[model samples]
Target: LLLLGLMRDEDTSDPEPLDRSGVDDDRLRLVFTCCHPALGLDARVALTLRVVGGLEVPEVARALLTTESTMYQRLVRAKRKITAARIPYRVPAADELPDRVHGVLHVIHLVYTEGHVASSGDDLLRVDLCREAIRLARLVADLMPADAEALGLLAHLLLTDARRAARTDARGRPVALEDQDRGRWDRDAVVEGTAILEHALGLGPPGPFQVQAAIAALHAEAPHWDATDWPQIAALYGELARIAPSPVVTVNRAAALAMADGPHVGLALLAGLEADERIDRYQPFHATRAELLARSGDSDGAAAAYRRAIELTGNAAEREALTERSRRALGR
Candidate 1:
C-alpha cells in the first residue's frame, strides 16, 4: 500500500534517482486493468503476477499457495468480472488514475519483492523474476512519470538490484547486506537509481516507496557497514511503521534499532511486536530476534530462536547459513 503523511520530515536533500525507460502503453494499461481495485486483493495480485510478472499459472499458484485449478478458476472469474462490469482495458483518465495507482504499485512491489528474495526456493535469488519485475517497474514509471511513488518504487528496485552480484558467496551461501562486497555492486544501476529517487523526492509529498528508496539510498551511500547511519535508518523505519504498519516492518525496524541503539533496545521492540501471533511463523522475525539475542549475550535464547527461524526458512542457502549461525550460537 502506498501510504501517505508519515514522513513530513523525511530527507529529500540527497535526492535519489530512478530508472528512466519506455513502456508499451497497451501493456501498461492491461496491467492496470488487472490490478483494478474492483478485484479482490488476492485476485489483483494473482492476475498481475500472472500477466505482468510473466509467471506461469502454476508458478502463480505456487506463489499464492493455491492449487492450479483453484488459481485458474480465480483468474477466469476475475477476467469474467472485468468484462461483465465493462472495465476499460485502456489507461484511466487523469481524474480516475489515483484510485487505481495504489493497486498497480502494490502488485509491482510484491513481484519485485518475491523475486529479490524468493519466499520459497532452492536458490536465494531468482534473476529471471527480478529482471521481469524491473521491466514491469520501468513500464509503471514511464506510464506515471509524475507519480512520485512510481518513481520511488523504480528507484528502490534498481538500487537494491544493484547489489545483486554481491548478495551471495561463491559457495552459493546468502550474504547479509552488512557483509556484501561493495566493489561487486553495479555502480551504473546505483547512479541511475539515485537520479530517479531525487526526482521522486522533489515531487514534494513523499510516500512509502520514497521512504524505502531513501533507506536504500542511505545504504548505497555508505562506504562500509560501520559507516551506515543506523540512527537515521532506524528513524526512517519508524516513519515507515507509522505510514504502513506490518509485522515485517516491525521486524526491520527492530533490527535497525538494534544497530542504532543496542541489542536490548531492539529486543524490546521485537518483544512488543511478537505479541502478534503471526510473527511466530515469520522467518525474518525469528532470524532477527536470534541475532539480537546473540548480541545481547543470551546464547541459549539465540540458539532457540535460530532453530525456529531455520524451521520457517524456505531457501536452501539461507537455511544453511542459519544452521551455521545456530551451531555457532550453541558453541557446537
Candidate 2:
C-alpha cells in the first residue's frame, strides 16, 4: 500500500545530508496515528502492524492464521474506512512515542523489502520505495540513537542497498547474487553499514533486524561469492528464524543452509514446507526449491519447481529467466 512509502509526499527530497546527531521525538508521529480507533480492533492492530509495525502482509496473515488474500482484503477494507472518514495524521505526544517506535521500525523494514524486490512489477527493484524507506530508517535511527533495532535496520538497508549497482546487468536483467560483480557495489554504503552493525551489536541482545544486519554484513564483507561466510550466515539465519519465525525467514535460512551445508540439507527443510500450502504460491520458495533440486540432480523435480516459480513470478524478465533455468534443468 502507499502507506509503506512516505507517510506524506512532501518529505521526498533529501536536499541536504541527514542529521543523525540528535533525537527527534516526532520522527514517526504518523505511525501512532495509523492505529485509529474507528477501525475494528483486529483491523487496526493489523493495519498498524503493517503500516507502522513493518510486518509484511503475508507475515501479518501468518500472525492471524489466515491467507494473505484474506488479510489483504481486510487491509483494503480498513484503508477505505480510514479514507472515507478522513482520518487525520497526528504526531504522538512525547509520552506515547516510546510504545510506537517498534512499529515505526517495522514500517521502514517492510518498505525496504518491497523496494528491494517488488511483489508485482515489470521492474525487479522499486528504487523510489527503497530510497524513501532508507530515508525514514535514517530518521528513526537518528531519533532513537540508543535503539539497537533502529541502528540494525538502518545497517541492513545500507548493506543490502550497497549491491544495487551490481544487482542487474548492463541490459537491466537482474543478475543472481553469486553472478553479480562485487566491484560495482557501493563501498561507502558497505563501510557505513558495517560500522553501524558493529555499534548495534554492542548495544545489547540482537533482535531480528540486528541479526539480519549481521547476515547482510557477512555478505558485504565477503570479497567474492564463494568467500562469503555461508556457515556464519546460516547460523545468523537460524537466529533470525528464532526471532522472526516466518516462512520468509525459514526459506531464507534454508537457502543459506544450502550454501553452508549442501543442497540436500536445504532440500530436507524445504520439503517440510511444501505441504504447508501457505508457501505453495510464494515465488521465492519455489525458486529456491528449484535451484536446490537442480543441484541435487533431480532434473524432473527441478523443472517442475522452476515452472511453478515462473508461473508465480510477476516480472516478465524474471519469468523468462526462470523458464531458461527450467530448460537447463531438464536438459542437464
Candidate 3:
C-alpha cells in the first residue's frame, strides 16, 4: 500500500520543476550579478529590459532616453564586466536565496514600473515588459516554492496584468476604471492570478506583495467598477503602505478612498501629495491628479495636469493617449 501511494504521488506531481540551476540560469545570474551599483540608472534599466525582458535594442534605447548607439555601448560594457568577473548564472544556494530574491525583486519591480508608466515617449503601458516580469516572477516562485514573498510577487503581477485589456479603449486612450468594460477583462489571467493569490495567502499572513495582490484580485473579481469593493481595497492599500510605503502607494490608496467615499475626499489627498518629491516628474502622478480634478469639475486645471503628463510621457502610444485626454479635458 505504501509503495502504491508513493507511485500515485509521483504521478500526480509536476512532471518537471523549472529549476534555476542550468546554463540559462547561470547567464541570468551573471546579468544581475554584473549589475554594479556604480552603473548609471539608465544603463541598468537598459540592460535589464534587453537581457531580462527580451526587449530589442531599439526598444530599450527608446525607453532609456538615449540613442541606439549609446544604449548598445552601455550593454556591451555591462556584458564585458560580467564576462570579466566570471559571474555564474546559476541560482544562489538555498541559504542565499533570500538575498538573491531581493535583487530579483528589484529588477522585476523596475521592469513593471517601466511598463506601468514608461519614462520617455508616448505610450503609457509596455505590455511586453509587464508580461516578461510576470514570467520572471513565475520562475522565481517555482524556484522558491516555500517562500511566500515569491508567491506573492507572482500573484500581484498576474492580477495586475489581468487588467490590461480594460485599461485602454479601442483607440488606446486611457479608460478610467469606472468606465472600463468589465466584460473585456482577461478572464484567464484573473483565474490564474486568483489561484496564485490563494496559494500565497495560504502560506502565511500577507506580505507587501500579497496585500497588493489582494487589492488587484478585488478589482479583478468585481462584476463592474461601480460594484468594486473599494473599502477593502483601501484597507489593503493601507496595509501595503505600512509594509512598503511610497508616494505611488499613497496615491493609489487615495484613489481607492475616492472611489469608496467621494471624489472631493480623494482630491484632498491628491492635493496633499502634489509636493511629494518622489513624484515630481512621475507622469502617472499628474495623470491621476488630473483624473481627480476632472471629476471635481475643474476642467481647466485638469487639462493643464493632463498636458504636463503628456510632456513627461515616454512611449508614443501613451503620449497619444494623454494628448487625447488633454484635448477632451480642454473641451477642444
Best by TM-score: 1
User: What are the lDDT figures for the candidates, one per model?
Assistant: 0.81, 0.77, 0.71
- TM-scores for all predictions: 0.83, 0.81, 0.76
List model 3 lDDT by residue over 1-332, tens digit each.
Answer: 22122223433334323344542554345345534344455555666677666567876765544577888898877655544444333466566677567556656766776676555544657777787678778777877888887888888888887778888777766776778888887889889988988987998888888888888889888897668899998888888889888777888988888888877877787777767654756667788788778888888888888888877675777777677766776677
Quality of model 1 by C-alpha lDDT: 0.81
Tell me the tens digit of each residue's lDDT in model 2 across 1-332: 46534334344443322323334534354454465556665576568657654557876665444678989999998877766555546544445556656766765676677677765556777787788788878877776788899899999999999999998777667888888899999999999999999999999999999998888888988999989999999999989888788888889999999998999999998878877776876888999999999999988888888878888786766776677667766774
- For each candidate in turn, give its C-alpha RMSD to the true structure in angstroms: 10.1, 6.8, 10.2
Clashing pairs in 1: 16-194, 16-197, 16-198, 17-193, 17-194, 17-195, 17-196, 17-197, 18-196, 18-197
lDDT, residue 147, candidate 3? 84
Residue-level lDDT tens digits of model 1 in 151-222: 999999999999999999998788888889999999999999999999999998888998999999999999
Please give the lDDT score for candidate 2.
0.77
Q: Rank the candidates by lDDT, best first.
A: 1, 2, 3
Model 3 compared with the native: what TM-score? 0.76
Of 1 and 2, the candidate ranking higher by TM-score: 1
Question: lDDT score, residue 306, model 1?
Answer: 93
